[model samples]
Target: MADYLSVSALTQYLKRKFDVDPYLGKVFLTGEISNFRLRPNAHQYFSLKDDNAKINAIMFKSSFQKLKFQPETGMKVLVTGRVSLYERTGEYQIYVDRMEPDGVGQLFEAYEQLKRKLADEGLFSRPKRPLPRFPKRIAVVTSPSGAVIRDIITTVRRRFPIAQIVLFPALVQGQEAAQDITRQIKRANQIGSFDTLIIGRGGGSIEDLWPFNEESVARAIAESQLPVISSVGHETDTTIADLVADVRAATPTAAAELAVPVLSDVLAEILKEQNRLYLATSNLVKNRQNQLNRIRQSYVFQQPQRLYEAYLQRLDTASRHLNQVMTTGVTDLEQRLQLVRQRLLAESPTRLTHDDQARVSRDTDFLNRAIQQSLQTKRQRMERAVQSLDQLSPLKIMGRGFTYTTADDEVMTSIKQLHPGTKIDLHFADGLATATVETVKPHEEE
Candidate 1:
């Protein structure tokens, strides 16, 4: 069996050999391309080689189309592929899953590294802002020319023409692209008044879209006061701008769609609201009309006199209650008055006077003796009080040889108060005399 191995068996054994080898199964390769050519609608056939070695490499059409750049012969490349043997040719080649120029590959690695860093920083975890329902203006940051601006304009106008498009042209690619995009973002913020911002370009290579992945652009997007929508490259592509922006649209036109609603949809909503209002108003009016009809057809309105009849019935019941209350009260009062009359007759003043006449005579004699005794005691007390008063009287003082003298309507108690020519009235207990003060003598201190 070892000496006579069939071609199929040999190829199959080699296929298994290449498949089973851990180093060759999947590989990371860096080399210069040789004999590389892009084939139309077919897989790419090329050779990857350095100065010392060479290996056949093939990228299927699906993988080739996904490359951001076209590969050329003698170009430095980085590739990821798996080693496999061609069944018919029995030749082992690398089936490349991904390939890129080494410089671009490094940039892509940087992109991924930065992406992970930002993710860890939670810059991508923030809640996305909501686009305004009816934005007054939408700011666009991109090159003024190209399909990006055109498609955005077309979509925005077609969907909601009322919202104005404010263009802040920025370099979307190049070394200064990140700075330009950052400047435009800040400029848009300075101008204000925009409810939404769309920053991006159309489909492009990784280098072309690199500005969107730059840290400056991502920081600007994260800091935007207005809701930012990122529309960079095609549907399959993503960038740091897309992660930080409030919304991500696959295309510029999609960004426009997100920025505003369809006019007809808004019209329909307004129409629905109008209809609801009309229905509510109609129902309210109809219910009120029904209530008014019921009121007009009520018994009170049908027979106008019945309204007063209810009041009359109530008045009659009240009148009967009042009569009953008054009659009961009068009867109670009469019974009470009869009891009072009997009590008054039993205690009549004239009968009492006759019954108590002899007792009154005896009480009167005793009362007269008591009155005489009380009068004698009171008279003696009064005479004592009168004698005390007489002792304090000025007439009593005059009897004791004390007199009151006056001059110029002033009492002169001291000789120094008298003036020689002053006329005064001398008052005594029994008499008054008009006299002139002839002289005044002051006694010596000794």
Candidate 2:
């Protein structure tokens, strides 16, 4: 065989061929993506596949950053790049410069992706806040020197001059404008004075109005505490900020109109309501006056005191009836008393006779003597019981030169209860004595 080339040499030779070939330098391809993963702030590495073949692909961070849509697995996409050999790995792959969805533009794909993401996160599902019927203080967030600001100011001034308009000028376009809009929104909340917020800009192309579609601006509008009115572009244009805002108006002037009530219309409504209230009050007063007059024509009102006359008459009649009933009750009670007196006089009091009184005296004397005898006998019996108790008491035995012995606080009555080295107590009439026995002597019965 001829001299064999090393792997590195072969790879370098192939790389030179690819670089010189104009067709390999710029190749456009369409395929399904596979093994696609986004590295944090780094380049992307993935594979592009079709039904019949597959190829390795890479995109540097610079090119990836310029992509409008994120590349995902299984996505059909078109890539514009060059095929080159990686000499160290000896692998030929495509280095992509730009990418887009296969059939649609990257912008449209990005729009769909962001819309789906926000929808899944419930950003668009939140309840829209109602606008104030009459805003007192309104804040406008837009460019200071634009037709949007001018239109808003003019519309609001013509509609409701009483409302105070505060302006928070912000950049409404370009790459850095999303962060600016977000900062202004937070600043508006920090100030905490405006009743409503209007964030808007004049109409422009999709690329020009892209700041309002940015995720940062959308998040800012969603998180705003104030009721946000979005008027980002023309009637035909819609942005993510509009989807997330509390209210969306077609134009800047419409946003302003929605923020505050029309002064003339409000004044006319006030006048109408005032007239309605006056007529209601007048009718009420007239009705009450007529009611009073009708009441005055009534019989009770005409007679003045007739309402109470019947009650007074009934009270007088009741008083007379009460007096007659009391007189009859008194006469009946007097007759009953006289009849009882006669009956009492006609009969003798057998319970109070002389013989009964004498018998009671004799019984009382007998009871007194019996009570005295019983008390004396009970006294003698109690004294005998007390003497018996005193004689039988253990303390009385102790007084007779007898000693009581105990061990461990238990009374010991037998010699067998003695234990050597045990503590013992000897109780006497005077006090007690504690003793320890060195030897036990159990007594034997003779």
Candidate 3:
């Protein structure tokens, strides 16, 4: 029993042995990742495995934050960390301090991931703006000493010398280059006068042009109010900035060409327009003069009175027709007046009065007959109604030997309403009598 040790004691001893070993303290391992799940704002736990075996790996949040690319399951990676044993679980694992993609394939994988993420967010799907056909002031964001700006300036000067060029110097390489490029883009916009922005650098390796691929640079280009023309690296190179910009150019010289029109071509077009205007003005003046000549040669101008000769003849014929119409209209009116006078005499007041008097006499007789018949009908109705009411009257009922009694000025309908010695009034056909109730009894009791 003295030689036996508990599981906890053995685990602790092994953990210490793994921790203090110098080779295990900083081991460089390369293997394929397995079971890797990203835990936002927390530590990552996964396994690194080769064909021979597998080892569990853990990366704390602080160390994982420094990773340049996302680590995923089945991705080959080179990790530098330490081997340590867990006392509680009795498992040996690697605590990764640093990790990176194993090869170029991994870097490309990271680029694809970012590309897909930005695409999902509609950053690449946004409508691209059209570059100004003739930019007055172009802003260039690139290395001040680079050949990119030189090519742009030379092309712009050779083509459109009157157009101004403003340079916003920025670092086009290295880690800090993305931030500087973004700042220059914003600054150029803040000035509020630049018509177009050209962002680029000379030919370089992917590492040298990585800043243009950065998310910050892409976002800045996408959000720019001014149109952006991206010309980065060689003709074959395309970056995130290029994808988001309003226009993409293979070289800086090509970008300048897109930004402004050729000075000679524009001047030639203006001269051509001027010549066309002169030709048109000459043709228009000649056409108008020819029309004036035709008008002068017309018969109306030759005779002068020919314009109103038909009107004078029309006036003479119209005057004779109007006089004849007036004579015929007067004769018709005279005949109508005589006919109306005869009709007036035929409808004189004397005849109308006799007819009106006869109508009144007949109406008076009819009214008198109607009044007599209405009075007779009302008198008959009253007699019948009086006879019916008399039949049902209390006086009439008393005359038939039936009487009613009232107690407290109300008719007594039930024997229960009266008791012995109750004062009551008896109403008969010819008189009303007063009496006191001696004995009140119902018909059943009687």
Candidate 4:
């Protein structure tokens, strides 16, 4: 046991050796990532392997957060980190601080990744603000000493002299450029009164124009309150700023032209419109005068009384026709009245009353005779019914010296109703007698 070293002790010795090794302190390695999976809020653990060898690699969340493009399994990457050993697992691994796609530059890869992400978020497809036809004042964001500002001012003054130009000076290159550009955009919007915003710089290489490609600059342009016209580089160059802006111009001069219209052309157009209006008004007045003169020379205007002649004749004829219609109507009404009077005389009240009285007298005499005959028939039928009912009456049978017996106050019609020792009542023609049954007598079979 004294000669044996525990596993923990051996692991600690190896870890110290790995940590202090000069070659392993800041190693630059290029390999394909394997078994890579994202771990939220924790360190990223994966394997990096080439065709010949493999090694375990881990990147802390802080370092992983700084990576612009997402890393996946089997992707080739270049990483800068140090080799270290884990005491518990007795395994050696690389701690990565920086990583990038193997072939492409880091900045370009980051740019493409951000662009895709924002496009997926619908930022690129968002409805862009429409540029105003005429801007009263414009704010330019760029390097104060650059040729871009000079070119914009000169072009604006040449095209639209009345329009005002204000410069919000900002760094347009290097790392701070993106932040400065975003700041200027916000400041311009905050101060207000600017109709348009122009952000640009002179033509340069991709690296020089990279600030405009930054995500902050792109987002600021997209979210700007004032319509932004981006003019970065020459006609062939396009940046993220250009895509997000309301309008893209090939050059700063073009941006200025887009901001304002040409004064001379506008003035000429106004003058032309004025001439057209004057001509239209003069033609309208002359035509109206010619129409009035033609109307004055008409025969109706010269003979004013003739205008109403047809109407007057129509009225006179209408009056005569009305008088004839009224006279004929009166005559017809008088004939109707005479006819109605004759009909009334034929149906006078006295004659109608006499006829009605004669009919009533005849009806009364006939009704009296019919009533007497009905009474005689009813009396004869009632006397015959009374005689038939008297012959079938039980009282008539009893009066013929017949008798009936009852038990329990009910009349007995059969001999079986009589039983020995049962009390009974005998009904005679004019009396009822109660008696006890001594014997029951029934009819004997012959």
* Per-candidate alpha-carbon RMSD to the true structure: 19.7, 18.3, 16.3, 14.9
The per-candidate count of clashes, in order, stands at: 0, 0, 0, 0
Instruction: Report the alpha-carbon TM-score of model 2 versus the true structure.
Output: 0.47
Q: Write the per-residue lDDT of candidate 2 for residues 239-324, one digit (tens) a residue.
A: 88999999999999999888988999999999999999999999999999999999989989788798999999999999999999
- lDDT winner between candidates 1 and 2: 2
Q: List the residue pairs that clash in candidate 4.
A: none
In the range 234-278, model 1's lDDT, one tens digit per residue, is 786788999899899998888999889999899999999999999
Which sequence of candidate numbers ranks them by TM-score, best first?
Answer: 4, 3, 1, 2
Candidate 3's residue-wise lDDT over 1-446, tens digit each? 98999999999999999999999999999987765657899999988876677899999999999988998655788999999998879999999999997753343455677788889989888998888777899999999998989999999999999889999999998879999999999999999998999999987544467799888999999889999999997675677888889899999999999998899999999999999999999999999999999999999989999999999999999999999999999999999999999999889899889989999999999999999999999999999999999898877777889989899999998889999999999988888899998987678855
Name the candidate that leads on TM-score: 4
Query: On a 0 to 100 scale, what is the lDDT of residue 394 in model 1?
Result: 85
Candidate 2 positional error at 229, Å: 0.2
Model 2 regions lying over 4 Å from their true place: 1-102, 303-446
Q: Give residue 307's error in model 3 in angstroms.
A: 2.0
lDDT, each prediction: 0.87, 0.88, 0.89, 0.89
**Positional deviation of 191 in candidate 1, in angstroms?**
0.7
Give the distance in Å from residue 313's predicted Cα in candidate 4 to where it truly belongs. 2.2
Candidate 1: segments with Cα more than 4 A from true spot: 1-58, 61-105, 299-446
Single out the weakest 10-residue window by summed lDDT for candidate 3.
Answer: 103-112
Worst 10 residues of 1 by lDDT: 102-111
